[model samples]
Target: MEFAKPLPNYLVTRYHGWKATSYQENKGWYRRLATEGQRPRAMVISCCDSRVHVTSIFGADQGEFFIHRNIANLVPPYQPDGDHHGTSATVEYAVTALQVSHLIVLGHSQCGGVQGCIDMCKGHAPQLEEKTSFVGRWMDILKPKYQLVQDIEDEEQQARQLERQSVVASLENLMTFPFVDEKVRDGSLSLHGLWTDIGEGGLECYDPKLELFTKV
Candidate 1:
């Protein structure tokens, strides 16, 4: 990391504030966490959107939830090709190593990644269709989902539908992992899908029985 610019001043200041408050309020808890290691009960897969705050929305404390974030909160199908796979690795560690009981795919409204998938599928984003563009290639996983919503007449509604589909797609992909499938079948693990409305601050959980997202 030579010749890189200095870290931003605001981030440095925020770190100091967090350190002082965290140590002052929960020094014992922090020490215990460091000594015992983490044992989060749930794992949350969410979009890498600034507006989608998993901890804040769930009121979770430190060491409670194992969180993983990607462009659109997608979990690609299990591919043990011995290549680089960040999301898959995270899921493997969470389920096999951590033994987390719940795995949740959390989608959100106004997701730029989802919108990019829509644009790429519609031939509107050429850069994303290029092989060199990492985002475009990563979003390819969600391209098939666009077809499910393409028939929707309203542009906003279509985008929203794709966002929800991202969650469902991730859930389906999670089941492709043999360990995940085994645990889920034996009742040791459960899968969940969720969507959030950024503007309305509303949360919805997907009901597999009805195949719809209802407010939580």
Candidate 2:
């Protein structure tokens, strides 16, 4: 018999222990948070990648930052047709329920979904089919941004440029929500695009001055 090791030993064990310890340390934090009383200063739209943990990235406590994550962190424009819009629902909760003041879209380098979109734009990836998996559907959000980034020369520069633009695209999509647009226009809300370069351990922000990402 091939004995399989326990699944939680590597990652889940440590994470669960941390959660328990955090609750022990801060007794009322989770309790208060569960009561639907959120006063978070910022809401982070992050990728579903295990490595791109929002709480760890910002060193946040249990209820510090309102977070939403999806494949590639893509946010589709708001619609009311009762779609499987986990991202859109989270945005609505953050903006309308929580009333978060700042919202940041965090995109990371070498995103698999974005890469698939780039490949599709280059005619290397397959089109939508019944066999098209979840990743293919998720990456469809990046089609336009990928094409826009390709207009730039320099292959190395093109990838970096696309990553940053994808972040901006997601941020722009956040405005499709009526509440987000209203708050943004009234100066009560601000949007920022952040890119995390995993290879370099650097967090970069969209620099309006240079029109590129700069390490922060």
Candidate 3:
């Protein structure tokens, strides 16, 4: 298509460099992965935020995790009459097709998507309230949880609370899928909620028993 653009020079150069070094060093492994196909043990649903590096956080190697990224790392409640459900489709593939044992919803502090939801909820960003705004509609999935933090007098604290809530909310929504529900109930699949502090490099996992996020 005439509309398609070429890769930027820097990215093209980086690709060539990686091919010559990393890819060559792991040529045998890459060949095996290409031949055998992937069998990632875990599926990680995380935000599209550029700073949130899902692999770097865990020091994971190639094909270790099946990763899906979306704004706020959300998983919408199951809707069978699907028209266009990207997140839902990925979850279906990960759970039913890939048979991934663990599904983790990863959220982060200072998340722009979470902050956008906060702004939209507080009526500070009128443009987001319009139906034509895709981000606004996506943020609606987390709108209800805003009520949990709105009364907080501190803005940073409020946003931080909602960030964690996003992870918890997505984990709940993941269970809404029948396949996920059945597997989780049978102890075949597990779900996790995690939040990361970007600047401090701290990670916290939600303790379902304590109903709070404890430092990792």
- Model 1, 99-162: lDDT tens digits are 9999999999999999999999888999888899999999988888888999999999999999
Could you tell me every candidate's TM-score relative to the true structure? 0.97, 0.83, 0.98
Q: Which segments of candidate 3 are over 4 A away from where they belong?
A: none
Candidate 2 residue spans exceeding 4 A from truth: 1-16, 31-36, 127-132, 151-156, 208-210
lDDT of 2 by residue, 7-45 (tens): 767698887887789768876777888886667899999
What's the candidate order when arranged by decreasing TM-score?
A: 3, 1, 2
Pairs in clash, predicted candidate 1 = none
Q: Candidate 3, overall lDDT?
A: 0.95
Q: What is the lDDT of residue 50 in candidate 2?
A: 79
Candidate that beats the other on lDDT, 1 or 2, i.e. the better one? 1
Ranking of models by lDDT: 1, 3, 2
Compute the lDDT of residue 32 as modeled in candidate 3: 90
